[model samples]
Target chain A: MENEPIIEVRQVNKSFGKNHVLRDFSMDVNQGENLVILGKSGSGKSVLIKCIIRLIDADSGSIKVLGNEINGLDQEPLDDLRSKIGFLFQSNALYDSMTVRQNLEFPLRIHWTKEERLKNGYSAVMEALTDVGLAHTIDMMPSELSGGMRKRIALARALILRPKVILYDEPTTGLDPVTGREISELMVSVQKKYNATSVIISHDMNCIRITSNRVIMLIEGRNYADDTFENLKKSNDPKIKEFFT
Target chain B: MNPLSTYIKESPFLKEIGEIALFTKRFFKEIAKPKQEYAEFLNQCFWIGYKSLILVGVTGFIMGLVLTIQSRPTLVEFGAESMLPSMVSVSLIREIAPVITALICAGKIGSGIGAELGSMRVTEQIDAMEVSGTNPFKYLVVTRVMAATLMLPVLSSLANAISLYGGYLGANIRGNVSWNLYWFQVFNVLNYGDVLPSLIKTFFFGFAIGIIGCYKGYYSQKGTEGVGRSATTAVIVASLLVFIIDLIAVQITDLLGLT
Candidate 1:
């Protein structure tokens, strides 16, 4: 990975009325690295990821993604910026009324031209599904799939655009251990294949261990700790040790 | 006393009204943008218009039949049984048909849109669309509102036609009024003023139903309970707005000397 940062969050703060969530948080995500954010439930991990994608505006701060200031862009330019960033929602957010193929085709329909889609849409969809090992389920509705399969389909949809940055919010939260590990493994392989930078929000230790090049602990709405999984595990601070134990 | 209850009752109403006004403004702004969502708009037209025909048709037929039958005795007492078709046709076309059709749509299409979009919101599908660089509001809201505005007028027209036919059948039930004479009487009493104002009002009714439905759904929170609340609230608000719009339309028509 290069020394240049792909994402820079500076002194970000957010609050929902009286309940402050993010308290002047700051972090940097370098290019071509898998950075996992670990936090307890309701620790603002999801909010942090949302801020990075401009899905949720920070109360105060500056966030730069791919060298563009997120807060300053207009709707059209923001949309264009978003096309280069993929997000895997915790719920998968697959359109239940549509088939997996249609769900996968949705992003391309928005961002790609008719000629471009006609030339490469099917092949692109096939490649994404193949990467997630769910090519057979293309015509199936999301309701027909198991949780793990749905996660895989969501991952495939995220990858279809060949995005430079993928934001994964709890990619393996609801799956069993084996399936979770499988998803984690796929995350690593997909990272290598696409050379895509990833910021994963997760509390699953196994997921963090398997997928993260570095881990950041979000505690009290700040970057409480930053280190590798092994080093973080060896830390003696009570809050850091709480996660490892 | 309960200060919280007072705040809950008073604040949410004012707050919701303000929010709905803002939502409506945003919808207008988004709709004015280029590259309308045509495919989704057509799909919504099919769902909201074509699928709603049977219910509106049946209700209108019954309304016309009942009105004719109920008025028959009074007309008989006045020795004006011949006036039955004119009276029923005027009532149906001038007011009953549009109101009934809009109410039915409020119950059916409004609730359906609210629940569908509410569930999508809760499940994060809307957010997912936004994150994927798609304009979910344009794709979801504008098309639905436009479809409802255009389709309700057409549905009302169809319902008015069916109701006249129903009035004909009711006229034949107790007397030997020929179809030709019945329709002739009906047409003689009708004019452009009677039809035009009623038709114009229905477009507003349709717009209200669609906008309220979308507003409820698009901003829903608190998960599944919120979805149910959105559907129920959409129907109630749209149904109420239909009457309010009808009342205003009546006053306008009266002032314009169309009534």
Candidate 2:
């Protein structure tokens, strides 16, 4: 809950061949801070997250996570570095071949404890599911769950690893307002409980309102505005105003 | 130029070459790195190995039966009807069953892994994996390749046995070869060389299919349509690689006087 930033991006750039998706984008995520990123479709919001995780290599600029430079690190250390961050995909990205329990157990099995020490892990999964209000559907397949439930399961999976930072990509995009609000509330509550840093990518105003104490608007791969929700609402920039309108 | 050779020459060789190059590149990248996602790998193996048994089994049996039946008349004409079981077993062990099984796997398991991974790629699950500190390639490619390499040989072995059974059925339908005599002749002609080399080659075929399919799918570009295209292309490319690898294996083994 201190003002120490856990994630820092300095002028990162990425492009697919000729098409530039992210250009000179920089942002900071403080420890225990819930920072919601608002951007229109294809504005490179997801790319920013991708750059942070090193999924897609950045074309230029340096990214530091917990004061460690991530861009040039070898695969082993990068993977070790990756174990500390949790990602909740927009589609939930649950392995359709696995049941919910299997899905939650997957990351833990790989990155955490072995099978013998799996009780704390199981309880953590159940705890995450309960936090997201999905404690009853432990054995269900991803295909069998509703969209909201799937997202919850994905959140549980992400949290099961007990990561320091959780990056949620379009968490509430596909859900109904009620479900979406519930998700936003869950994110906020989870952030408070874990005292973990959160970076959410969404255009949903409700998500921004509920989850973000700090909002950063990305317009055309650069920060359009960086402020609290109220200030973003009152900003005189036409594009920013138009976005709210 | 003759029609068949000309057609082969005129086929999309460059596209195939590009695909092969891409596949090789992706495989090296996957192996040259770390970030092993064991959970995802085991899951893939379960899908690619455990679920594919029935299809490979059925095809293996049919291939044996059909080849035996078709070859019986030719053998009978040469007064070599007694060689039917041996001939069928050799054919199944050396070529038909392994290749056919691989083709089937390319169609079933290969394309499935391809499409699933391709779709995951397009939808940003792969990206999510990376940002979350997971290596998509290790999690996606190595597990799948390892699964295919391990499972395909087992499937091929099973296919060979079933195919011999099919040959027995086909031989008994009209021929005079008894069960004991048929198997005895087959065993008499069979050597460790014929069986082992062919079996050894099948592991490569499995590896090729797994790698190529995974490569095509993992690097799949575009969106939903791209995923579908990647799946189809993965099967086609992996099947073609199986043939190429088989040809190379034959030449190498021949040069070494093993086959």
Candidate 3:
């Protein structure tokens, strides 16, 4: 169980109309590894993770997450599988209408019953908020928060379920450098806290340097290179070198 | 291909109709399945019903008053002044109030649903709900559509009663028509025939408005511009649907000899 890949993609292909976004892309993420998927904008980084969750079905090939082939799993099983995966969107998709508490509780409302919530909901919310250093923002709406704070709250909500596999889509794309670093550090702490595996999609060098154990360079819709962050930084292959330079 | 067949093949309109039909079928299937959102449904009812009541009532009153006043001059000219209350009651119950209320809801409730859901879709909140392992369609679409479907009739009924009172006040505007006489005329001329057909049509009107609004918002593309477009199209399409459904209802009532 420990040696088996936590998330596996075997020759996955996806396209939008004539735009072939992913051309026979394949990857394997081992247990507790922080795998940063580095790619330019519109390079199918987001599509790959969405496919792993079956949010968008792959055009062809296999994706197994936590040992379940997810391509055509029934709704009941798909839902059960989803409870173990936490996704942090690039936009920090906190419900704008809901307060921070409600935003955090939205997942619980769906996945847990009344009794389970009554017992542990408050503490869980408090713990998550505390982890993100936003305990004071429980009653605040997302619009009231700054971009960094919203991202933190989204991270808190994603971690509230204590998911085993966390996917981050361009986690620090829009933040100032200091705030982005803070998010990167928080992400690392969370990985330690849960011993969770992460597949982060980001082009931020500082974030990748801080968080990635292994880096996968996605170039032209394929995993062009997979190596340690240090090795990738030293890569001479022009496609991989262009990213570092 | 002939023009008609060519139009059918190439027209986005036909394609949209097919898409809407599929979306409507999905709503039915999603509603019948497990995982209904009762709390959210109640919340949507508060928004669609309680929020829209006062506006509907005021419009009804104004419509009734104006109809009575305008008809009074024509009746007085014909020396048929006593027929005011009976005519106003029949006209309001049979057609005007329902159509007016539905058109008003098309502007208010339909646009509201479109903008709300459109913003949600553009923001990825709907996708977030899906990622959270919840059916966004079941929560967002079904609850709002169901609320709109149920709320329109209740609002229309309230509007009808208010409009009758407004007619009474309007009847007294130019010349004195006693309260008792007005009631006598209203109830005496009114049969199940006048009320039933209009009430039945209001349900159809409500369904059309809600479904159109939801459909526009659910499939909204682009971003903020798309949201604005969806809201506008919701109002336009729903208003058109209200008229179409009303015409069909009237034809049905006429065929049944209910008119």
Relative to the true structure, candidate 1 reaches a TM of 0.97
- For this target, which candidate reaches the highest DockQ against the unseen true structure? 1
Backbone clashes for every candidate come to 0, 2, 0
Tell me the tens digit of each residue's lDDT in model 1 across A107-218.
9988999999999999999999999999999999999999999999999999999999999999999999999999999999999999999999999999999999999999
Give lDDT tens digits, candidate 3, residues A107-178: 999789999999999999999999999999999999999999999999999999999999999999899999
Top-scoring candidate (TM-score) = 3
lDDT of 2 at B55: 84
DockQ of all predictions against the true structure, Cα-based: 0.89, 0.43, 0.80
Clashing pairs in 2: A53-B131, A82-B133
Model 3 misplaced stretches (Cα beyond 4 Å): B1-6
Measured by lDDT, the strongest candidate is 1
Interface RMSD of 1: 0.6
For all the candidates, what are their Cα RMSDs to the real structure?
Answer: 2.2, 4.5, 1.2
Model 2 stretches astray by more than 4 angstroms: B1-50, B131-134
lDDT agreement of model 1 with the native? 0.94
The CAPRI quality class of candidate 3 comes to high
Error of 1 at A145 (Å): 0.9
Could you tell me which residue pairs clash in candidate 1? none
lDDT of 2: 0.84
